[model samples]
Target: MKIEVNMTETKSNDSETITTTQQTSGAKNDSSKGPESIYTVPLLKLIKEAQQQHGLRHGDYQRYRTYCSSRLHRLRKVLHFPQGDRKGFKKREVTLDNLKDEKFVYLPLIQAERAWAYAMQLKQESNTEPRKKFHLVARLRKAVSHTIHLEYICQSPLCDARTKLEAQAYSAWMQGTLFFELQEWKQASEKLVLSQTIYEKLASALNEDEQILYKQRVEELNPNLRYCAYNIGDSSAQQDLLNMRSKGGKSELDALIAQTREKQAASLLEVTWRGRTVPVRLEKIRVFLLAYQGLDASLGKANDCDAKLSAYETILLDCKEAIQSLKEDLAAVAKTKVDLQSSQLGSQQYLLSYLTFLRATLTIDRNLVMVDVFQKNFAAYQSGESKKVAKPQEGVKLYEAMVQLSGELQQLQGMENDKKFQNDLELLTKVFKAFRCYYMALTCQGNRQWAEALALYQRAETYINQSEGKKLGDSEFTKYSRVGQDLAHLRSLVNSGKCAAHAQNILGVEDINAAMSGLSVRSKKVYAAPDLQIWRLAVYKLILYM
Candidate 1:
């Protein structure tokens, strides 16, 4: 593949015109059939990984640009390929002879990234200062030039097919983006389609983990393709965009697309929760609720309790911000003395209560997960192989926290008559109690109170049994199933503790000796010294009987 850039005079945007044409078929290599070198660079993987490591993960283009510049500097110094000294500017071009190491390919790639990031930074500011559009276009053209050279370098026989294809795809994507920004719908659509095709092909041939980045790029291109198609008078563009929006994922691109669409459809302001439609007038709150719809999917993807808890933390933080924004909006309204209708005010209040309930419920869930971690750690420590030590008291405290949070969730304004919510809370409360009793039993056993430990373990067994007998939802079933396993183990421990306590009661001498051994000699003299008068009376009575 090869790309040719043509500069022409155009009356649009008062900027220099740039046009890109690419040969997608056979990229004819003019270099002699040199050694069949095994030099290769996974261009797409490297660029995507770098973007993720830099600020591109969070869309901070300026930070990413800085990182790219520093990377190019380091690569240049290490390869002894400096462009120039401070006195004069001398441009260094990458040629076939200089491509001795794979790192040589990194030079143009990073340069392209640096230029592209600068272009994006300028694009953000171009809204206010239209003059920046000229600079943005220039940077994009520079990036395209670098990618063209990168693709040409990768076409050498030394490079592998994967390297060559990735370079071609990257060049096509850059050109498509430049055309898309220029509103050249025909050119943009063609290049984006080519890039999308290559990416899809690459993704199809890779393993699941390796395919993620390629597929992600394809998803990002979909919106641009649809927009370009719409500009080109495609009838299905709108429907295609809607379909893409509906098939959203947890990617940052998808979230941004969803947010933009939601803001554009401001009239669609209602959110349905638990079979009730609530009007969410504030745009911030509405957007938040829409994004919140994906929380379950995010949690479901998490394979462990910690990962799920972290997911909850992130969404709960977003919920906090939304609630704060709503409160500010409401305060401004109240200060202005705008008389809100009773129904509207009631609905807004209900929304507030609903958000609180959601937060509280998630907090309860997070606490429960922590309790599980604590119990597992303690159990592992008891098994005597784990180096990490967690006390039963810690587990008991976490369970106490879960119980409090569950009660608060049940008492939230919107949850007063929510039978389903109440049932879940009731069941959760029982689970919390059962775990608390189990932890307390372990604490008692640690303190050598065998009788108290046995009683507490029995209480825990009863509570767990009751919880297991109740009807459970899918999530609740998963949680209670683990609880059942823990209880089963506790039952055996409880039985052994019971036997030990019973034996202590029967052979009371050992118990007395154990208790006495713990006291000081002074304490023993005060409490255990024989009584002289009682001994004399017993002796005299014995002599008379004999």
Candidate 2:
């Protein structure tokens, strides 16, 4: 009842999925080939740059969302792919079958961006309107869907390698962000790690300037990774935060601080130092340590130096209170005649020593922060980059404070036998002394005390030499390299300053000698005895006149 037909399926570049059919009774047979993979798009680069230009560079998600909407409208209009009239809204989809040009790929990208931006915008408002949290998650879910579709489109044979890679990575990141919001730590970490790895690989293959954006994206992923790790109970998460804060990127971490503290309160139960473990039995000390962990984030949000200093002062006050409480506990324990062999007694002593070390270190940090500020001002003045007056005396005071702190750190019980700690402390002491002398020299230079300034410069050079003589491992050397570089730079400045000072002194002496010589010549002429004949002539002339 049916005619026998032989049909063959094949793909064609001209249509979505072209099918060629062959019959045994047909006069001819036809076949089609798949589309060529010639299409290339720098999808990540294009979107990242555009995002930065619009608003994400300044963290304005609403603005970026608006921009994405406009961009999508323009793209649709240019491609003549409008879904419907302005009054009658209709939906259009991008798929491998419908895509005719490489530019068609931007449709899903823009769609995803719009949804992501909306989610972030909602996130900012979710604090005031808790109901918006649901909307934010919904938007993120929509973003994830668009990214998934984009990845699907890029998997077509028409898409090139780069486009495929970018699509995959972007999809992973979107899924990761969604999972992060959903508090799925394990899934979020895996997806984010994949995204980070791809970006890092791309960065390594790029030129220096082009590598920056990708590398920055990788860095942005680090805090999220660390937070996820912390949530998943990774012990190294705290150390990661410390390292990141040391590099001065704490401002970007403000959002993580509150949640991290909340989590750490329950998670942090012990302290480790000098190959020893001690239980954190006191709630006050535990709370103090929790506050200390937020130090960088809190200070980073400060508007000015004074605000930052106030934050530190507050922490220092807490440190003092915690120490007092610990001291009282120790005193009470002593009255009970606690055995030295007991782990509790040992732990208490270790905790006390740890607290002492922490306090000293914080004091040093506070002083060093001020020193850094003063140094920046002075440097700006010397470079003619600022109109502010240089204040080397302020830096000298801070260096003196650091020197004292370093001495105290060296006197800590465990530190006395720790070779690495002692060596670092020694190096720190020498560097502080060098900086102190350098600052004093700057002050003397400002006052035109050339001799004193020169002497101080020589003294600074001595300290710098002493510090440089001691050996350091690779890691330690890397840690100290910045200060070493600064010292080397200061040496050049000292040399140039000395030369200029000598020249100024020579010019001053020549000017003084010239003035004195002119005065002496006039005085000798006025007092010379040979002027008596001229005086007699003058007297005769006066008598004639009379």
Considering every candidate listed, which one attains the maximal lDDT? 2
Best model number under TM-score: 1
**Residues 1-546 of candidate 2: C-alpha lDDT, one tens digit per residue:** 122223343435323232211211122234322222356777788888888899988899989999999999999998889988879978889977766667789999999999999999999999899999999999999999999999999997667777788898899999999999999999999999999998888888778988898898888888889988988988889656644543456555645744666555677789877668898877678768888877887777777777777777867987898899999998998899857464233777778888987788788767866877887888898899999987888888888988888899888765567787777778888888998998898788789877777788788878878876464443422445556557677777766666555554554555556556667643743332346545644665567459
Model 1: per-residue Cα lDDT at residue 347: 68
lDDT of 1 by residue, 1-546 (tens): 222223344555422212101111112242222222445687888988898899888889999999999999999998889998989879998898766667889999999999999999998899799999999999999999999999999998668888888999999999998997787989999999999999999999889998998998897888887767766788677445534543444453454455454744476578666667788787767666755666676666677987777777866886898889878877887898767455333666678877876677667667767877876787789899798978889978888887887788778776677677678678777877887887787788778776677678778768867776565463423444555456556656656655554343333454477567768955654344347435644665567459
Task: Quickly count the clashes in candidate 2.
Answer: 0
Regions of candidate 1 where Cα sits further than 4 Å from its true position: 1-115, 123-170, 179-268, 274-276, 295-307, 338-345, 366-381, 384-390, 414-427, 449-546
Write down the TM-score of every candidate.
0.55, 0.52
Q: Which ten-residue region of model 1 has the weakest summed lDDT?
A: 17-26
